[model samples]
Target: MARQGRHGATRRQPKGVAFDRWLDRVVTVAVLTAMVIGLTAVAAHWLL
Candidate 1:
């Protein structure tokens, strides 16, 4: 039997992991913003 030509390695695409990482970053930023706003409001009310 004869062998086939062009035995190159295939490239892999990690779209799922990339999307998950992006989603986590977005959620972390949103949570941090909410916490900062809540703390500022609480401090203002307590000082008044």
Candidate 2:
């Protein structure tokens, strides 16, 4: 039963468009976090 449940979960996982959308979200968040940190560093440099 446990093995079957694992197989079912994997089988039901997303594909194609859904996977692309998921990857896009991950990349966007990563980029935004980088930008925010970069901007903060620049601001601190200018202030000091």
Task: Using lDDT, give the best candidate's number.
Answer: 1
Candidate 1 weakest lDDT stretch, 10 residues = 6-15
RMSD of each: 7.0, 5.6
lDDT of each: 0.92, 0.86
Candidate 2 per-residue lDDT, tens place, 1-48, comes to 444535344556455878899999999999999999999999999999
The TM-score of candidate 2 is 0.66
Q: Pull out the clashing pairs in model 2.
A: none
Q: Judge candidate 2 at residue 17 and give its lDDT.
A: 77
Cα TM-score per model: 0.67, 0.66
